[model samples]
Target chain A: MEHLLPLAAALPLVAAALLPAVAWRRPDAAWGWAVAVGAGLLGIVGLLLRRLLQDGPFSYAVGGWAPPWGIELRFDALSAFSLGIALVGVAVLVFSGRYAQAAVPPQRRAWYYSLLLVNLGGLVGFACAADLFNLFVCMELVSVSSYALVAAGGGRIAALAAFKYLVAGAVSSLLVLFAVGILHALTGSLNMADVALRLADVEARGPVLLALGALTAGFMVKAALFPLHLWLPDAHASAPSPVSAVLSALVVKLGVLGLARVLPLFAGLDWLVLAPLHEGLAWLGAIAIVAGALAALLQEDLKLMLAYSTVSNIGYIVLGLGLATPLAMTGGLVHVFYHALIKATLFLAAGAIIHQAGFRTLRDLRGVGRAMPWTGVALSLGVLAIVGLPPTAGFLGKWYLLLGALEAGRPGFAVALLAGALLIFVYYLRILNAFYFRAPLREQILAVREAPLSMLLPVMALALLCLLGGLFGSGPVALAALAAARLAGGG
Target chain B: MRRLLTALALAIVGAVMLAGLAGLPRPGDPAAPVHTHVAAHIVAHGVEDTGSRNLVTAVLLAYRAYDTFGEVVVIFAALAAVMVVLAPAAAPPPGKTAPPPSPAPAVAPSPVVGFVIRLLAPFIAAFAALVLWHGEALPGGGFQAGVILGALLVLLSVVMGRGLEQPLVPAAAARWLQAAGPLAFAAAMLIGLAGAGAVLGLPAEPAWGRHAVLLLLELGIGLGGAAIILGLYLQMRGH
Candidate 1:
């Protein structure tokens, strides 16, 4: 079982080596190799999560050296976040099979598969890393892969978008490196727990606070939070559908996880105060929710709208994080998973539409529901779940977040939360109305049919997970509660 | 107006960050926590524990080897990305699976440059191998050696006045070679499991097994780094 710890990173890497070789002789086998790696990863991540839940949180010291001297990877209830991420990786690889054949050029399939597996390994390692420097390396791994993944769809716009995303990500990464340098100078420890322990009486309040600020700003850009999110919609929209799904579903969340990993260092410490930071995050989140939803309402491109909606959804999670109560933390963590499920469904369904019918804008996709009913149904369920209808997986995160907001005595945030939900409903109605009520604007809509089983299975599975995530919300809620308890208790 | 707004926003951010920076401790305090704790231990004992006279190599290969493994993978990902983006825009139409056409037109090598490369290649190879061998004891290590070798290879290709995908090192072989660093580290991780039960950990006794593992891993990094750097150059130039 301990061996499984390092294998999470090693397996995909070994696959990364083998993938291009497989791609050389049998371009067809590349996808199979990626799926095999993802399946192996799925089992490993699932076992890690189960073991963590059963035995409580555990930490592995890499290379048999204990920490303060070596790196560590820790798994707690919070790692449930990655269990879901790993599942999404598996589903997306499976989904990309038939979808990539049409959307990506034949020559590029192996490269795409290689990038996807490497990206997955990066995410898994990022979630598990407890060493600050290790976290930086892992963050870079995901960011670099995503920058290229964004460009994989192959168009002038995609190249431009990838470059933009690269610039933003590079700044974020540099800031993280700077912060790590400051922390290292202050504590001489790269192991997070070790640093936290050494910094108990940090004398120079200014540098510590400055480092925290740098880190927060860096992660904010990566997370696409509010003003820092300028690169997101374009990067997410222009990217191929499966790539978009991964970007929206998994990539940004790693930024949030990076923040979660670091914030614990200064939780109750005096040199770096956290109260004001949380307060700032709440207002930032409130603005993001309203601003993102309003912007989403005006988008013409279907994928662009979904991308902006991701911005709005990210706000909910951040707001919950800002609320800072145990319940709010639970909501934020749970939303992290539920949103991944819903957004992946929405984007994959949208990808199917684009692949089959060649439409991108809402106006162009009018009456697509009648032509591709299965994709439409999955899209409708995803829209329902995202709009926070009861008994959907999406509802649980919002419910906890709203309750946390109200309980924390921030009724204004609760109002903002509600208003954001209502605003989201209006735009989702626009999508549904176009799907069901609007007349078919083009002859191509009549020729469209259900997506292939490979793509559709993952779409439907995620939609069902959303429905069941809500129906069986108790499991996630309990897990999230436990995670929140672990976080609050540790810091 | 937009420019003014942008300026105003930038000013506000600068102000906030300045406020935060105002609070940091003075740099390099001799009595700081860093000097008191982790740094003291590593400087005092790291060499003894990891058997590498170079503290950086010791830390990189033994104590924090897992991070180095991840670092190598990140490099591989960057190479893969460059390959994907530069994939010949005019690849044979889907379903055709034709052999890749010859690389973009090769630049003719000047006689002086070819003569220089011919003279330098052997020395560079010897020096790179020397660095890889002595990495555990000296400042030179896998990355430096890899760069030296990789530069020589690329230089050779340019001087030969040919595309990179020759029979000597085909595209498939290049990809595998580029990944050699991570593959080596992965092998080390498995070998490491035999000793420490923890991934990438060396045995407490700092002797033969450890040195053997270190040499294997360093050679892997040296070779991997050279392959990837050359591969990246070829991808950009060839495409």
Candidate 2:
């Protein structure tokens, strides 16, 4: 069962290698090969998930060596993130098949598919890595592919944006490596569990504290937390839509995952020490929520609006975790999946609209709903869900988070949560108004047909999942509680 | 004011870090926790079980080869990224076709420099191989060998001119060479299944097979790394 883990990460990579060479002769079939690899990954991940949950968490020691001497791939609540990440990979790749034709040219499609494969492989590896250094390597695979993917379809602005992103990302990655080196110096082991144990025995809490600070600061940059998020808007907005969907829905979450994995190693510290860190995080989350929404509210381009909204939504998740209650952390965990589904649906629907209608601004895209009603429905549902309307996937995460804030005696954060939701509703309303209430600003929109069935299927499927997930929120709620308990309860 | 704020923030952070670091044991203390636990295990059992006289080799190749595998993939990703960046931009369909691929012109090297590099190239090439082969028992390993080989290629370019690097292996061929590291690592990992050991774990019973696989992996990585280093320099210095 443990052997399946390496295969899940490797299968995509092997395909990534074979794809360009294979597609040299067949261009249309390049996507098919990628989709096949994605499907295989989903299957492998499903079996691993079942084994992981049933076995109540285990670690696979790489090279059959014991911990502290070998790298380990852990199976836990955080690692289960691989399953969700893989699911997103399959959905986005399926959407990209027909949709990619518009954005990426035929000459670059093969390279695009290989880059996608490498990206997914990196995500899976990042989620499962139990050794700190292994995590960094996995992240490099992710970062490099994503940087290239941004500049992929070829545009001057896209190249500039990707370079900006690369600078911020590379700097943070180096900071993470620096922190890991500090921890290795203090603990003498690369395995995360071993590091935690050895640190408990060490006399110096200073290096441990410093490591935690560096790791958190580094990841905050990656996560695009309010202040350090300058690169995100351009990178997410300019990249081709399929790449945008993954970057917005999934990539930044790795930063959150890094915090989840590393910060807990220092949880053994006294409340007085840990409180300020969480408190500071909570403050940052609050500011990010308001600031991200305000910025999103002002964006003229539909895609840019959605990009900024990601920043706001991430604020909500970070705020939930910052509250540091089991219930709040559970809310954050539930948000990870809920937001992934909602954001992916929204981006895919938006991409279809842009591809079919040939407009990116809200004013130009006005009344596009009349021509493409299915995509309109998906877009409306996504907007409503993102604003936390009832009977939608997005409501439950905020509900629990709000409850957690009140329970934690931080009624102020609860107020901030309400304000943030209202802010989200305001910006998303602009989109809804543009789609429905306004008349078509351009006559060309009247000639626009529905997006091809290949693109429409994933959008509607995700929209349907949102409704079902909302209706059956109990199962996810329970799972979230379990994940939160496992994380906060300490290993 | 902004600079003042920045400096203030930096000072606070640095002070906190230094305070925390002071609590740590002195650097390189043999009595430290890191030295006692995992490091101790490797020092004690590395040679006998892993069959690598060098403790670093035992650790890198046998005990934690999986991490090394990931590092291989990371370098491979760098090469792939550089290629995609240097790839020709898409031509508009029917409106305009992409320019035809042109053979890049070679830059001529100075006579003295060329003579010197030509004279020294073989010794470097031979030494790189020795490092690659003796990595198990010596300080030099795949990375060092790879660096040596990359230097040799750089020398070749200077001696024989710019075409020496690209013509030695085409961009198309260099990509395959670059990917060889991860592919070889994967092969090594899958072969470990015969012993039912974890990924990249070699079996003790088949001692020769174990050593042979390790040597193969080192050679593969060294070759792949050398190719990629040269590839990156050439592609970045585009025509």
Task: Compute the lDDT of residue A8 as modeled in candidate 1.
Answer: 83
- In order, the interface RMSDs are 2.0, 2.2
TM-score, prediction 1: 0.95
Pairs in steric clash, model 1: A63-B200, A63-B201, A206-B23, A206-B24, A207-B23, A207-B24
- lDDT on C-alpha atoms for all candidate structures: 0.85, 0.83
lDDT of 2 by residue, A1-491 (tens): 67988777878876786576677666788889999999999999899889866886777877788777888887776777787678778989999998878788676788788888988988898888888988888888889899989888678888999999999999899889989988888878889888877667666666776788889999998899888899999999999898998998889998888888887677665532677888888889888999999999999999999999999988988897789998888888888878888888888899999999999999999999989999999988888889999899999999999999988999999999899999999999899999888999999999999988889988888888777777888867876788788678765
Q: Please tell me how candidate 1 rates in CAPRI terms.
A: medium
* Model 2 bad stretches (over 4 Å): A25-29, A105-107, A270-272, B1-19, B92-107, B111-120, B154-166, B170-172
For model 1, the superposed segments whose C-alpha errors exceed 4 Å read B1-30, B93-107, B165-168, B203-206
Top of the candidates by DockQ: 1
Could you tell me every candidate's TM-score relative to the true structure?
0.95, 0.94
Backbone clash count, each prediction separately? 6, 2
| DockQ (model 1, Cα) | 0.63
